[model samples]
Target: MMSGFCRTPFKYQIMKKITLILVTLFVFGCKPTEKAVETKLNYQSQVAVKGDWQVTDVSYANSDYIKVSLFDLGNTKCFVNSTWHFISNNNKGSMKINDYSCAYESDITWYINQNNEMVIKFLNGTKSKKVTTGYVVQYVPINENKFQLIEQADVLNKTQDIVLTFERI
Candidate 1:
């Protein structure tokens, strides 16, 4: 009878340990997992501007200012009639300048951000990520076949809009 009594307490102790472990596992297993939320890129404007486009015109709200260089490539006149090709699927494109003695071409990566800004990076044989400098312009769509890239420029200490009109080809 004494030996049985000792064994019963030992069994109870083992049972208590097993129950504690099971309860711990149950509590931890039922916990909700945390997941990282990723921001989805807006593709509406991307789809609307996808295709071949030509710079039909470049105009400034205040035209009394001096010659302005655009994107450090050349004068604003150089970009007029330039060709731009946008590939929405890969967010890559190219700009070709065949006017105003500014004969130049470059591979570019572009994307429309959540703020409706067109961000462009000119890659001159360098990786897209390696190029730190970029240009941001407000993207304004006039219609399916036409759009405007408005860049704010400081002219005589005043902010002015330099609009570049594009037409689909």
Candidate 2:
């Protein structure tokens, strides 16, 4: 009787181990491993956008009715003529607003994600990991020398894109 009790527990231990192994294998095996598809345009856009750029224009659909403050910095007009330096090697850059009243500069880290959106974060002298707030904008490349960062804003109770056109410098 004693031997039978010990044998039963041994059998249960083996069964538990088997069940655990199977569950782990099933869980891991079912996990999706497909990588995100990287399009040619993504690579080309990154290449096209890299280097020094100047914001030549900033326009919105209905600017006359709605006034927008961009990046919590200043008016959209302040961004015009701003200089942006995009270093592709580490995807780090700086933005300098040269508009007389809004003269400011900040360190930024940016990247073109798999979705073709340009994600940017203003470090503002802080570490990138410490900064949680960031911005994502539609990245449109007209040519190697020209690109647009389109950001959506609430204008007159509707969503509108504030387009910032950039030309390579």
RMSD of each: 11.9, 6.4
TM-score, predicted candidate 1 vs. hidden true structure: 0.73
* TM-score, cand. 2: 0.73
| Candidate 2 residue-wise lDDT, 1-169, digit = tens | 8999989999999999999999999999999996443433355567667899999999987676667988788899989899999887678899999988989999999888667788889999999999988887888878778889999888777888999999988
Q: Can you write out model 1's per-residue Cα lDDT over 33-145, one digit (the tens) per residue?
A: 96322234459989999999999999986454677778889888889889999999999999999885888999999988777788889999899989988888888989999
C-alpha local distance difference test of each model: 0.88, 0.86
- Give the residue spans of candidate 1 off by over 4 A: 1-40, 62-65
Candidate 2 lDDT (Cα, 0 to 1)? 0.86
Question: What is the RMSD of candidate 2?
Answer: 6.4
TM-score of each: 0.73, 0.73
In terms of lDDT, the poorest run of 10 residues in model 2 is: 35-44
- Tell me how far the alpha carbon of residue 36 in candidate 1 is from the true structure, in angstroms, after superposition: 21
